[model samples]
Target: IHVNISAEIIKCPQFVRALTIAIVIVCSKPNHSYEDFFDHVHVKLLTCYIRSEPLPEPEIQAREVQCLYGIQIMSAALEHPGGMVLRLFHKLYQDSVISKESFELWKKEDEFKAGFDEDLETKTMAVVVLISFFLSLA
Candidate 1:
């Protein structure tokens, strides 16, 4: 899960590409779930940033943590069903784990991309579960 990215590219574009490649390599490792991979990357990236520069403003750190939790919850919800997921999503939105606008956009996009009638209850449950998971992490 701990990915080491090193490159000679100094240009921003090339650096981004290299970073992406590093992430891909880490994520593609066997026997690791996406959530675990993400956690590892987040911890490493945050640690590096903290060590190399001024610490993030408290608000920024809080927001980043929220975002990470939101992602984790979303992944969890995708694997289960119930009203809990929906409630969790709503809570995250309210708590600013995800911006409301972004959540709406994601919801719309997901609906469109579903390609069929997905169960409303299930979708709601997934969101709730994801939100709950995020809060728990926080």
Candidate 2:
């Protein structure tokens, strides 16, 4: 929807790729509840981030785990802008669909704290902006 199917947003290629993965997972399951969608999307991303040859670490790529949670929030926000972002986040929290740990993890991430560091090339500044507006209901 941002452009052609293979297109990546120029400013944040890594984040855009991550966003695309989130969007695809959502589009593939329109009727899935947030819980079900979360479980399903998480597995899909693990496949992309993990390798069979050798295990990277025991953390299960915690950064991606939190960002996976973040993109779902971001996607819903984009789909329905305005205060809907906060509202959806609250509902997700109340329902226990998203955990408090994920919120904290996202906030601590370097991309969230360090501003738009082109050096990292992740450039997930949008998530940082969203976090600043966050209410921290947890």
Which number leads on TM-score? 2
Highest lDDT among the candidates is held by which one?
2
Please count the clashing residue pairs in each candidate, in the order shown: 10, 0
Question: Once superposed on the true structure, which residue ranges of model 2 sit more than 4 Å away at CA?
Answer: 1-80, 112-138
TM-scores for candidates 1 onward, in order: 0.29, 0.35
Cα deviation of 122, candidate 2, in Å: 11
- Please, what are the lDDT tens digits per residue for candidate 1 over residues 44-63? 55334323334335433433
User: What digit string (tens of lDDT, one per residue) describes model 2 on residues 19-92?
Assistant: 43565456444454444333445444434433222434333344334444445445544453343334444544
Distance from true position, residue 90, model 1, in Å?
Answer: 19
What local lDDT does model 2 show for residue 59?
A: 34
Candidate 2 residue 31 C-alpha distance from true site, Å:
18
